[model samples]
Each structure stands twice: as C-alpha cells, then as structure tokens.
Target: MSKTIESIFKPHLKPKEVYQGGKNPPTSNGKKIYKLSSNENPLGQSPKATEALLKAAKHIDVYPDQTDIRLREALVKDFDGQLNANQFICGNSGSEIIDMLLRAFVNEGDEVIYSNPCFLPYAVFSRWYGAKQVDVPLLNTTYDLDLEGILNAVTDKTKIIFLTSPNNPTGTYIPKSVLDDFFTRIPKDIVIVFDEVYRHFADAEDYISGLPYVTEGHNVVAVNSFSKTYGLAGQRIGYCYTTQTIANYVRQIHKPFLLPITSIEAAIGALNDTDFIAETVKTVQVGRKYLTAEFDKLGIKYWPTQGNFFIIDPPLPEFEFTDMLMEQGIMVRPVSQFGAPGKVRITIGTQEANEALVKALKK
Candidate 1:
C-alpha cells in the first residue's frame, strides 16, 4: 500500500480552504495601478516609526523582549486605566492573538459563536480546533450583529463569542448599548473576544471597544493591531487586553520572543507619533466621504462605513465588477468569500486613488 501525506494529516485538514487575501495589482499593461484592494493606509508607514525601525536595526543581533513589556505598558497608558500591562498578551499580530485565544479556550465538541459575513479567521480558528461553529446571520441590509439571535444561539457547549467593531468588509459596528445588554445576559464563563482592529477609524457615537467591559472585569478581550492606524501592517505587531487570568493563560500558549525587536521599536514609535495618527485618520475619513459622494452620483448602492473600507452592491456580479475595475488599473476586494454575495469592498485610498476608482466605476 502506498502511504500518502494526506493520510498522516488530521482528517479535517483536507477540507479546510485557504484564505485568499487581496492580490497585488497587475502591472502587465504598464499602467499606473492604484491598489485599494487591501485596507492599508494610503499615506504609508509613520515617518517616526520608520526612523525608529532604522535605528533599532543596530541591535538586530540581540533577541527581542519575550514579553513585550514596554509595548504593553504603552497600551495601558494609552487606555488610561481601562487596562493594565498584566492584562495584555502581545503577539505577532491581532490574528495571532485570535488564534491563541481559540487554542487556549476552545476544545473539541465546544461551540464558538460569531456572526456570518464577519472576519473569516474566527470560523477558521474554530474549525482548526475541531470545535463546533455557531454562526448567527447579520441583521438584514445593515450587517449589524443580531444580538438577540446570538443570545438565543448560546448553549452549554458554547465556549467563546467573537465580535468585531466596524466589522471587516461591511464596516458596521456594534453599538455601545447593545454591548452593554449583551454583556449583562451572556454566561460569565463564556469568553468574549472583540476584534477592534479598526477601532481607530470608528467615529460613530454608539461604537464601543471591548476595553470598558474588560475594565469592569467581564470575561472580554479586545484585540488591536498596529497595522491600521499606524500603517505598520508589514510589521505584524498587535496586542490584546483581558483579565490578568486570561492574559496569563494566553501568554502560556504564545511563542517566546514572538515580536521582533525592530517591530516592537516601530510600534512604540507609531504609538508616540500622535500627528501621524491624526493625519492618517483624517485622510481615511475624507476618502470615505469622497467615495460615498462619488458612488452616490454614480447611483451605486453602498453600505455606510465606519472603517477604512466599505462594501458596494454592484450592478454586475462582484467578481465581474472587480475584473472590470482591474482592467482600468484599479484593485478592490470582492466579498463573495466573506459570504456577502454581489458585493465588493473598496478600501479608502488617497484622494488621487479614490478619484481614479470612482472614474473607473463610472466607465
């Protein structure tokens, strides 16, 4: 009998689909391509961060602090007592912390709850651990979490609940009132993981991060990434805030020396560069409005957004519309994989890039 690699792997691994990130714009036509596919900062990395990274290169020979103490302290200081350094679990990225949370809390036969058409990683992590997934459908049209539905779905088997503010692809968020109610009703034993990766972009009056709940000593953890506001996606640095108990458990499962020295230095610099953060947020806010106005003029249907990207229900199929845009040297994300059919996500780029995207959509 011939032995196969698949035979040695876990049975569930065979059916697991790989995630497809946004593609790099095609340069075959030699046209100037404006990449608004990935939700990246159009202004690029913080200049202060860049300088810090370059300076930190001199110490490449040494290992990074295994615990990321300085970054954790900075986070606590930023939050003004909402969290403490001991309540943190710094990781290579927010996604990494998500994975760690699942590994630490979820077990085979346990159920994990999340909204459909949300961040894909939540479902992926649950599946990887052989856990049952309970996906509640979003409220129709608005794409907000069906809080009542999620509450009803809870069972004794449910171990974790994942919520995202300014949720990926759709850009909608859970209001503070809803969160307050949900926290009150949910089981205290069940862990709540709030993915607030785009928290910086959210300006809605009702939006709330998981930090306050964490402050109140709820079983909640809020994940944040430097990738968005700091323009440090390439650095792959992020952190989470939870109770000291949960934080200690997560740190046990996390790899040692997880963050590179340069990444840590860059993130610290990014945190300190208030001017760069202000400009980046302003640019995204302006671009978001510009895109919305332009889409309105073109009679395109788009979801209202609180993040750096928004979804558009195009006249044609999403992939078809994306291809049409690509022909004009523009790139945007198709959301079919995210379970939002007939929709595409357009990242808020610079004024020039946003205008070009609008012009292409018009064509």
Candidate 2:
C-alpha cells in the first residue's frame, strides 16, 4: 500500500512564481539610492513602536501568547474599544490573512472575485488554495473598481469577493455609494473582505472604510496591516476584524501561533504610536500633492489616488523605465505582472526621495 510521494501531493499543485519587490540598494558602489518603491513608510516606525520593540527584545527566549491577547486589546482600543477579542485575528502578515480567508471558505470550483492589476500577492494565495480567481479588468490605469462588471461576474460558485479600496499600484478607490450598493446586491452568504492596508492614507471623500458593515452583521472582514503606515513590514503583523463565527472558522483552519511573539509586541507598540501615524499621513498627503504636480507639469497621465501609491503611464514602456530607474539606484514597481504592460507603480517616499524621483523622471 505504498503510494509515491508525488501521487499523494495535490494534483492541482502548481509551482508558484517568485515575487519580486523593491530593493534597497546598498550604500556602496558610490551610487546614491533613492527608493520610491514598495509602498513603505519612508519616515520609518514610530518612536513608541521602536521603544516597544526594544523592550520586547529582552524576552527573546520566551514564546509569545498564541492568542495575541495584548495585540487584540490594543486593537479594541484603537477601534474606540467597542469590540473585543473575538472580533479580531492577528497574522504574521496581511498576506497570511489573505491565505487564511481563501482556505477557510473557498473550495475547489468555488469562485473568488478580485480586481486585476491589484495586489498580485493575493493571486499566489488564492490560486494555491484552490479557488478560481476571477479577475475583473481595471477601468483605466488607476483601475477604478468596475462595480457593475464585478457584480455581473458573480454567480452561485462565487464564495468570496474582495475590495481593496484605494486599490494597490493604481491607488484608485471605489466610491462609498458604489460599495454600499454592492453590499446590498451581493448575497450575505458570500464572504466579502475589505483589504484596507492603506486606509490611513486615503482621505478622499469617496473613500469609505468597511468596518461599519462588520458591525452590521454583514459577512464582511476588514483586513489590514501594520506594514505600510506603521512601518512594520519586516515584522509582518496584521489583523482582521470580522464576525465571531468567521473568526472561529478561521481559527480552525489557521496555522497556530502565526503571529510570532515579537510581532505581537511590535503591533501593540505601533497601535499606541498615534503621533507617528499622524506624521505619516501628513507626509504622504504633502508628497502626494507634490507628485501629482510633477505629473501634471510633465503632462504625464495618472489617476488621482487617495492611497500612498499610484500608477502612471510615462511616455516610455515600463520595462525600460524600470530598468533606467534601477540603474540610477532608484526602485519603482513595473505593472507587467499586474496585467498592465506599459504602466508603473510609484510609492510616495520621504521628501528627499520624492524630489529625487521627480528629477530622475525629468531626465
């Protein structure tokens, strides 16, 4: 009764592609590195979060609480202290939560809806979990969510719908009205997840956070990360808010102790760092305006984005543009993998980095 290991492996198993991200060019080689990529917090982490990390570092030998009690309490307070532990689930990364959501609800032949040219990171998870990822095309370079098109794509097999307001790379958002209507039309049985990793950066009047629906008994989950705004990308701590029942289901399928002890402590520290959050918002808004102005002056076409990153179609092809930027010791994401062969995504960095990018583009 000896079965070969290859036969036992899931037949649907497909080799995954290696994810390419922005690189922090080392300071050597006498080249000045200006990294306006990877949508990271250019200013760095909050002092409070940094202090908390240092303090927590002393307990390196001990295992962290698997329940992530402290981080949950911090999330409660951050959400006005109205919700409790059951409403939340922390993960090693927002990417991990994406994997958990698909694994918990999606099945073979079940459909999952998402925007094309979005956080391609999710594609790896959705495909690996056996859910057929139904990609909806973006309207323009920004990929303003095509609500009507997505609605038409849904069917009985659709198990999950994802909305990344102020969507990745493109930085375009679905209006609140469109979102409300989608919520009304979609069957409540289907799980909806609002990936709001850049929520703090979005101040557009049309942009709306999906937390209110979570409180309204809608089968919705709000997934976010401490990486971008809180500067915890390396720590990889993210949390999800949803109904208790879904949280319980996620727990059953979720890998145990997913949030390492240090990550939990770092997230708790990040929550209390309100000043750092405020500073990050102010910096991005200021830099965003500046970036848009540069685009306007150069007559470059771009979408108005409420999030920290946005897509732009320069006069040249992105592959060549990206290579040029890399040679200059600057990193920007080219959108070929996200389905846009000609456009590139740029993240707002510090003032200095932004200015350098502007000059680089001008040349």
lDDT tens readout by residue for model 1, 270-308: 988999999999999998889888888999998899999
Which candidate number has the best TM-score? 1
Minimum summed lDDT over a 10-residue window in model 2 is located at 10-19
Report the CA-based lDDT of candidate 2 relative to the real structure: 0.83
Predicted candidate 2 versus true structure: per-residue lDDT over 1-363, tens digit per residue:
888778767655656674576676566478787777789998888788888888888987976676776788889999996677878988888888887888888887789998887888667677776778798887863477888888899999999888887788788887889888988998868999889999999888778887878888789999999999999988988989998788888878656566677788788888988888999999999999999999899888888888887788867878888888777667887877776778888989888988988888888
Clashes within 3 Å, all models in order: 0, 0
Question: In model 1, where is the ten-residue run with the lowest total lDDT?
Answer: 10-19
lDDT of each: 0.88, 0.83
lDDT of 1 at 253: 78
Task: Give me candidate 1's TM-score against the actual structure.
Answer: 0.96
- Alpha carbon deviation, residue 244, candidate 2 (Å): 2.4
Cα misplacement distance, residue 250 of candidate 1 (Å): 1.7
Cα RMSDs of all predictions?
1.6, 1.9
